[model samples]
Target: MSSYLIRNAQILGGAPQDILVDGGVIQQIGPGPTVEADIDIDATGLILLPGLVDLHTHLREPGKEDAETVLTGTQAAAKGGFTAVHAMANTTPVADNATVVEQVWQLGRDSGYCDVHPVGAVTVGLEGKELAELAAMHGSAAGVRVFSDDGKCVDDAVLMRAALEFAKSVDGVVAQHAQEPRLTEGAQMNEGTVSAELGLGGWPAVAEEAIIARDVLLAGHLGARLHVCHLSTVGSVRIVRWAKSQGWDVTAEVTPHHLLLTDEMVRSGDPVFKVNPPLRTETDVLALREALADGTIDAVATDHAPHPDADKDCAWAVAAMGMVGLETALSVVQQTMVDTGLMNWEGVADRMSHRPARIGRLTGQGRPIAVGEPANLVLFDPAHRSVVDAATFATRSRNTPFRGLELPGRVHATFLRGMPTVLAGELVDQGDLS
Candidate 1:
């Protein structure tokens, strides 16, 4: 390990200051600190923030190696300025049991790219029928604090209530995908004029809102916590807002794509624009942005689903549902939220880093850049502009929709425990990549 000093950097939308890091902790943050380190980074015009944390990320390990692996996924996360990401348990072998969950956790630790917390599956194999070994997974070496049936909805009310009750005993949260399977059966895209015109099955707003409404009340009744994943509709936002007002232990997250893009992008007939809880209307997008700004939404997590090119290049009806989001999350946030005056850089840090960390219970991540805090940080060049190029991505999948789109703000460096895991937008392998 080496020491470093980031000089004259803007600290989380604050004034420019010098920060010193040694032994993986911030030693000082002041004007012209009289300290020396093994390395010096002249971040004169950069913004320094606590490393971003993604509460929802799919690593696709223990199965699906052709799409992505823990090593490649974490590398992509590091390149995106994330110090920690909770890996969704929708892998090939599903992280439903202790053995699989611990394997995923150990792989993340061995990779040394970013902190990976495995989210345990709420149901066996995510079938939404039998409950998984929740207590066993929570007690495993992974110490799983979050359980979810991410790719599928835990739609059975009794089963959902049971999961919520079980989470209460372990202080864990049940993160629901929030889509009513019946309403979304064979759903192809957002339910509106566009889907009707394209002859595609519509996924209506009520499908998501209905599930959220049920789960929040269930959580309140069970005295447990519930988190809504990738909330996409205005009605859903309204429900989450009302739920919060009612003093329910409920938190919700919106993906970067939902915040920036909309159902209009699907008009191109590109599968890259397809996503679960599909891209919504402009009104929904506006409502979600407002909700995120007003604290109705707790965090902005990247549902960074990656897929092989063959799986994503098909027709709209048959294509995969997701986009590669890790490497471009901050840029999208800067373009959609910060630059639009809806949020500042500090708010970006909060939504992307601090809040997600708190929601997922990741202790060493999302800390403020102050003396004695862990040196998990990101150096961002706000003025830098770059076109999204999937060919250059660190992930194995090239499913990004932002290709050739000019995006503002670039992640210059990401330091995990005082070591630069990503430098100048490229991943630094610590003997992990073959």
Candidate 2:
């Protein structure tokens, strides 16, 4: 059986202890004896977390391999300390059915970097018209538990309600992109002083907030799970908080970009900063931080949308709306949430790993750092700070807005099932043999 000894790692940022993994399970925890092992890591001074899990990652495969593939995207996830990532359903020919999702799932299994759970589409072709065969996708080998049209919203109230009801039967979550198409017509950046000064069309906060309000009510009424993706504005947070206060089955996620960046960054006219649910104001950023720390926001998903250089290098008006995020997610969170004192390492683990896994219904992922649990884990160096370099990313695309920015924290190593996918901050394919 494969075995590993993680020596002197601080579990959940607590006291240092040795952890032993045998045959993909945590066989022992505590001051374990140092002995022969198939793999051993000198993890002294490194903070160990349950392997991070991202509920929203766009792998862009099966058609957009020019941007990203299951292999490269999972490589980015592994670099970010994520053991699992939910591949969004917006691929070319869209992952709206079991066949497409299974293909993505099988690709991830073959990659051997991170476990990729494919998010099936909520509608047939994401057209907001006919509903996709949600049950078929869920029951397929992919075992898709989350359904979303993500790049588009299910604006038809009838369709939204029907999706909620249908999801109830199979216990699936319907995650929404939450943009009101009418409200965001021709929108370019966040609707505010910056957009006015820059003479660019604006995406209003109300556009996102209105949908969250409607969908949370729909989800509550139907008694099904609703997940709000990449929540950006203050108004959206308020709606999510109210839904939670009422004990409705609704959860919200804020991306790393929204938590740290403001719409003002668009003033530079750099297409790299452009993203859907356009980055909001400083006030919104602070509120998002508070909401996440207080549990009003459930998780931090890296809306890891990777676009090739040609797509993102165009003029602002025509540039694609996304930024590659997986490799930088943990660093941004460490800088914005932990270093700012809004949350501790344990809180980061909960938001980044535990809650996301639970939301996606991933049994093997997001397990606790304890005995008898799956040995998916990350060893992070909080003291490590490095400059952001898109050129060095594992992703095929380099549309990151964080380029040239210095960020704190680093993933020293990431282990998936007692095998290292990344060791000493570099990728290795040896884990496939395990």
Q: For model 1, how does the per-residue alpha-carbon lDDT over 195-248 read when each residue is reduced to its tens digit?
A: 999888899999999999999989888789999999999999999999999899
Q: Which candidate is the best by lDDT?
A: 2
Per-candidate total of colliding backbone pairs: 0, 0
Please list the residue runs of candidate 1 whose C-alpha ends up more than 4 Å from where it truly belongs after superposition.
431-434
Model 2: lDDT equals: 0.92
Model 2 residue 180 CA deviation (Å) reads 0.3
Please list the C-alpha lDDT of all candidates, in the order they appear.
Answer: 0.91, 0.92
lDDT of 2 by residue, 283-368 (tens): 99999999999999999999999998888888999999998899999999999998999999999999999999989888999988
Worst lDDT 10-window in candidate 1: 425-434
Residue 193 shift from truth in candidate 1, angstroms: 0.9
For candidate 1, what is the lDDT? 0.91
